[model samples]
Target: MELFNSALGKNITFVHPKFFIIGGLTGIPNITFYYVFLFFVYIVSVVGNTVVMAVIYLDHNLRTPKYIAVFNLAFVDLFGNTALVPKVLDIFLFGHYYIPYNDCLTFLFFCYTCLSLQSFNLVALSYDRMVAIIFPLHYQVKVTHRFMFSFIASLWVFTIIAVLISVGLLTRLSFCKSVVINSYFCDHGQIYRLACNDHFPSYVIACLYPVIIFWLPLAFILLSYLYIGYTLVKVATGEERLKALKTCTSHVILVANFFLPLVGTNIAAVASYIHPNARIINSTLTYTIPALLNPIIYALKTEEVMNAVKKLWKKKTFINTA
Candidate 1:
């Protein structure tokens, strides 16, 4: 770990084509330029997510539970992107691959913690939508400010405890020298790969934690929508029914697209633990593709988000014209 800050850290040991894809596509082969490219992504994700949150916050007309849920989701995502991207961009720019031991652990802890929080937030949002569609009158009282605040507080507490326990368990192990992470960030799975001791517990925890947290909520989201669709069919009014159906459809699509890749990646990570080839495929789906596609997914599926973005853009243009 002491070698992290030494001049030797500047020497590049490995350069894979996958890591240089952005540089290749951009026709700029310089390693320094790749750092700039990653920073561009970091800036776009932060700005776009921040705008989403701000739109939800400033627009009193958008103060429903569904949109409030979206606001919280965007807020968590903003934190998520910030926690991971800066370190990654810094490593690329400075040509320093070594992180101090404590800093490495801290990075892994918070990154996974934020990732857990974001996934849980998605689950909560799905439940909120489910209630709104399945029982409109009940949703107001059920998903009130007080209730949501308590719910979010509980989620943070639970996630922190789980992550701390996982980290404490991890801390007991010693890391050997094979530290070049195939993934951009120091993810828990990647970090565990370097552990010199028995890794059964780490693998078990990694597989079980995500499954319990992500899959359980995903099951609920799927079931809730199925019931919602059934109930919608019984409604009498055509226009009112269409409105309810449209909203439910949007929520279902968003939930599926988000959870499918997430769950698949988690499972793939387990397989990758055994087979090296699987890790590369999982890396592409988990890191590269999902980061780029999340905003596009929301825009394509949710008219509300699309309209809000358009409104925000037109306002920006008008201000510029003035």
Candidate 2:
């Protein structure tokens, strides 16, 4: 056992002790109920996102540059949720609580990548809205399919590269002790906290990464909306102004829904006084809640999506009556 531990430790600097998830520690009287609730949420998120993508793809009218961004956002939500939630369920329900060291790092990489992509995609959506609202005359000329495709490609490439660099930096850290991560899944901050070596550089990068990935895009979205607001005010027609405002509102809601929980999760993770259960719940919600809500928010709030859904429902009802 000593030789096996030594060999494994030599290859991978740290092997974590079996980590306890927040869901398991929430002190709920009936743990089975919590697992059932989470399982239901996971199923809803998957089905909801998949339906959004299908609706967008099947409806030829909805396939605009703007909806393309929406489609991509839904895709990210689905991908991100799928990547994290199953492992969380495994930990909570199946008692597969101990994640191998390398597996944890791999999951962390994809989670961060999805988060970065989601943020960048939101920024792209803001830009799409900005152009459509502020420069409607030139929007067609400016925001081409080619341009949107290239922009999305660039977002994926950039995020993948950034995550790679971050993971590379993480690899350099030594974890001599088996630490227990308090949260569900492998949260970046929680993983970083477990490192036995000097974490100053990792800490610096971790702090800066959220700023670059989350806040910077958030700032861009806000600035774009500010200009959008300014442009809406100058519009002479009340009808046009209302229409423009309605278009941007959904994007704004989605942005808030995604970022607020994200920021809150980070805060709860770092704040010493915050309960571990709260941090875990926050982290779990940060991924699952957004995934479940994205489709519902877009479907209800965005006019095109609502119309498409109505049309599809009518078509199905008509067929049934026939």
Candidate 3:
């Protein structure tokens, strides 16, 4: 855990460690290539998620409860990538590896908050889908804009409270040595691993945190989908069942896109035999790749979004021709 040594022929006792971020310590032959790749991902994530949010905001047809949830997810993705990728770029492209203590904590706070918000948003989207499929007649009556807004607001408040409690606990831990985090960005697990004091409380919180934030929401989503499936099966019309299943396809894809990398990263974290570089790589991809792909997946697979894009493009073309 001793991270520094003074070579002045004297014993050095006091050292305040500034975190050294080693971006994916994979020992790639060409680091610049990796930097360029990450830069492209950053740009795509920002632009794609921004465009998704903008389209959702401007289009009146997209102002439903489902698309409102999509808008929130896009916003979270945009905010998260903005908070994380620039610092990663600084580390890989500009060689600025030293992060101050407070800055590191701030980054970890926002990253955790955004991720937790996304999980809650997904649960909201699943509920929206369930209501739409199971009770189409009552969907409008029950899932009003006012209700959706209140639900989303409550989710934000809950996520903020949960993340603050966790981050507040994190800030109290002492980091006397071993400040080098072997990842591209400041992550909760990485930061907690470097604590020099009694981190039992933090460790307990960490173990329980994912269960509350991620798995619970995921379980709700699965149950919603299960109910939707049962409802579809009871429907006598083949076309109705197909339509219902089609509506759920994009959400299922999105859920897989977000959760697979997360599960992989968590697995790597606890597997002691895994390489540090592999763990770092998994963690980096867990956040960044999902942020980059979420919008793409929706635009390509979701019929409503694609129709919106086409309509917008046609309108632009008509205006240009006129």
Candidate 4:
């Protein structure tokens, strides 16, 4: 590119590959069975997230700042699963393993953008709950639709820019080594390491992405809850504390589902020698299972969402009968 040429100068002759072979999940035992299972996951994820989004959209009572984040979260979950699962099935199940370089980067962009947004969306939800619980009287003024929309928009812009910069850095890499990417998709780390030239920038991103996208959001959620707990203890009665804490059950479950497996797998990989097959499976599931479970958890655990769904169903039934 003109940008790449200008940045790296005329002396650098980059060996940009025409295509990358996705070799992850390539040789595990009975991988077809896993793909079949993922097929069903894709199905349920689509249905559940669709229902969640539809319910939020149709119900006037559910149109709060909190449900805005919930709707965004559901949308991201659906988009992420759609971006990931079908391509994965195509790559391994149907034996279409090769992806062009530009297409690969585009794939990485969609998948990672959606992935990052999931955590950011959770942060929004946590913030919503924190303000609602800790500053109930001021919540109306503090956590308005305008504020949430702005906050969530900024989060989206931030995630997109960070991911774009990382993807751009890959353009400078000269892959003199094997073109076979070790991860399931066009993984940033696997692709960059294959480059023969200086890849320190890519390496930095590989290290930093986890912290920015995962750990930071996780810490923020925990801190928000700590403040919520402190405020509840200082002001509310014991019964009141329990009632307030009950409101957070759905968010807590969502947080645990999203963060724990990712943190756990990263910790395990760092602490010991993990097999490639096992590591790949864990990482894949970490990306996937949460999307499948998020809407289900929210719908069942939050009485508001359940009631909204029932209300929408009853209205539909009434219209049909008329």
- For model 1, the superposed segments whose C-alpha errors exceed 4 Å read 1-38, 176-182, 198-200, 234-241, 263-322
Q: What is the per-residue lDDT of model 1 for residues 144-260, given as tens digits with 9 covering 90 to 100?
A: 877777787898899888887676555555654555555556567766666777777778888888676777777877777777778777873778778877776655655665677
lDDT of 4 at 126: 94
Q: On lDDT, who's better, 1 or 4? A: 4
Q: Candidate 3, after superposition: displacement of residue 195 in Å?
A: 2.4
Model 4 Cα lDDT, one tens digit per residue, 1-322? 4475577676666788999999998878888999999999999999999999999999989999999999999999999999999999999999999999889989999999999999999999999999999889999999999999999999999999999889888888888779999888989888898999999999999999989999899999999999999998899999999999999999999999999999888888888768878989999899999999999998899999999888888988999999
What global local distance difference test value does model 2 have? 0.79
TM-score, per-candidate, Cα-based: 0.74, 0.86, 0.88, 0.97
Report the poorest 10 consecutive residues by lDDT, candidate 3: 1-10
lDDT of each: 0.65, 0.79, 0.80, 0.92
- Model 3: which residue pairs collide? none
Per-residue lDDT tens digits for candidate 3, residues 221-321, read 98898888887888737988988888888889888888877877777667875677767766777778888999999999998999898888898899999
In model 2, where do residues sit more than 4 Å from their true spots? 1-31, 264-273, 314-322
Error of 2 at 322 (Å): 6.4
Ranking by lDDT: 4, 3, 2, 1
Ranking by TM-score: 4, 3, 2, 1
Each prediction's number of clashing residue pairs: 0, 0, 0, 0
Candidate 4 achieves a global lDDT of 0.92
Error of 1 at 33 (Å): 8.3
